[model samples]
Target: MDILHTLNIASSMTATVFRGGAGIATHPAGAQPEMLLELYDFEGCPHCRLVREVLTELDLDARIYPCPKGGKLFRAKVLELGGKTQFPFLVDANTRTQMYEAADIIRYLYSTYAARQRPWYWRIIEIQRLLSIIAGLPRLGSGSRARPRSAGPPAHPLELYSFEANPFARPVRDVLCVLELPYILRSTGCPAWGASATDPAPGSRNRARLQARAGEISIPYLIDPNTSTQMKESADIIRYLLRTYGQTENGQTKK
Candidate 1:
């Protein structure tokens, strides 16, 4: 399918969810950490989506290990570390902390990294839960199934430039989740201010810089350092993943 078509589908899937990190609360000052935060989750999970939305609102970066159902690579890692398959599991190497549960994770993020005043929207935890579940309906079960084969894992984690509300990014993330490939999430949300100092629109400098570095502004962009392959478009990325990693000894995607 075309990129525009894919984006349209993604947008339709996440209609109720606010875009550009609206309504979510954020810290006035950025938090600097010694180590990158690690998360094990599937892109299609409502719970995981909540955490990622919060991450984007806070403008925090994370190392993601996709844990789609029937996945073999990171699923075992989640089991080893957390002793369960439950996700949105977070590990803070700097603080030596590992945690599960969406509500708890949200609270921890605010207290540890955000300003003292948390967003009122987040206070309505139940509402957030409901909305997240609603947002997840479009892509339900897309990332849960396992393929019959396996591609040997890469040496280094891949990198993805995306924001929570992006539809194209969602499908790419889903594929990664099912494949259990770990990656660095580079968020690219809209700017808070306009072009001028007095304007409120966020400037384009940051996004422009990222695009210049990557050679494109369109997201769900993937960079595989191990293979030195960087590309855009979700469908193409999915195809690449299947061709590279889909077949295992049993001729099935690893489950």
Candidate 2:
């Protein structure tokens, strides 16, 4: 299992390389919005991946609504509002603006949060989209489709501290996607010890908070306020998700 996990993440890392560091660190969103941003996306979609990358890079937090293929939860809601079933649709409550298309969402994020123009690479639109498709190839649709499960919504949005390309973090995001669970994605694109004036911190509490819980700061740290659990290590986190949410690690559904 460990070897397979390593191989899985290695390919995810390779996909990150292909993305050219889009979600690697914080870029200091200009005048943060009071309302949390919302994203309707599935984990394995290349188009959705680009929008998520920018969210991490800008160090912005969002309420993620996973709309995996064939998922009944949020797909209908998206279609009702947007008039189509599209992944990576963004809704900004702060501005009451909603739109589709990866490139457009990226531009909106930069304009609204980063207060800058979209990067040049994004200008080449076609190439960027192609690379995103390639990135999803390795994960093989782990978060691309929904699965059978029984559960009720959490009282609060689960928070995840993850950088877009963290191989370890990808699996957690996948499970969250599969369950259609909403989460606040807190990105550590530029580590605290490495942040710049332009690149702000992911969050102040993340470092100290993880240290207190995991004995050291780490990526893929999960904070499930509903369960009052904070921990690291991907496999353990997956198991906890199953148990806390009522299921088994072997993929058996619980009633």
Candidate 3:
């Protein structure tokens, strides 16, 4: 792996550790919404991170619309839809529910889908905010700001199999956010690390499908139908995205 990319992964690992691996496990949701869930959030926001972890824990997939700061894309859409600018807004068309505030969102998700009371730890939103902010420090400012998009969005939303707090997955998500790419987040959360590929949670449908399709359960796996590319490994994915979307028509790479 490239040394800087290795360091980026290491920093992400530290962030995951600081958050206590909140998104590491999959809990069976009471029901999957008939309609897709929509999440409006940026990658680096602490509150957004919390909401994402819960989504993973519940093993729910959602359509992710990245709203990175200074982004001209979905940021405006969120304001128009919600009547205000919020970092982590959720819209469940299934229930005609639209709301903001990470704490409230977490509660709504648990009550609506999981049909279980929030765990004691998850209930402590204050502590969660502190820890998540601290967790974000290692890669502060990244995935928070938008980079200019040289290319328009894909014909179809990309698909990514990942869980929140995954060291290898975080970087890929960051790039997607920066480029303002919408995607289907396939929540492949496992009960534990090191066992995710060899042995996943018994109820993890995403994991089983991933294993059968990819021939393994290794994560941060990306499928870009627009380009007909399915790939693994964060480094390669990042390079591919930058090359495809972060470059000028004249073939100049843009930061």
Stretches > 4 Å off in candidate 2? 191-215, 246-255
Model 3 backbone overlap count = 0
Question: Which runs of model 1 end up more than 4 angstroms from their true locations?
Answer: 1-29, 193-209, 248-255
Model 1's alpha-carbon lDDT is 0.70
Scored by TM-score, the top model is 3
What TM-score, to 2 decimals, does candidate 2 have? Answer: 0.87
Relative to the true structure, candidate 1 reaches a TM of 0.82
Q: Which runs in model 3 stand beyond 4 Å of their true positions?
A: 192-201, 248-255
Q: List TM-score per model, in order.
A: 0.82, 0.87, 0.93
C-alpha lDDT score of every prediction, in listed order: 0.70, 0.78, 0.89
**Candidate 3 residues 85-106, lDDT tens each?**
9979999999999999999999
For 112-142, candidate 1 gives per-residue lDDT tens digits of 8766655787788788878777666665567
The residue-by-residue lDDT of candidate 2 on 1-255, one tens digit each, is 678777877877877787776667565577677888999999999888888888876777788998999887899989999999988899999999999998888888888887677778778878878988877777777788876555666788888878787778988888888888888887655553454323224443344555566676688988899988887888888777756664555656542
Give the lDDT of residue 150 in candidate 1. Answer: 62
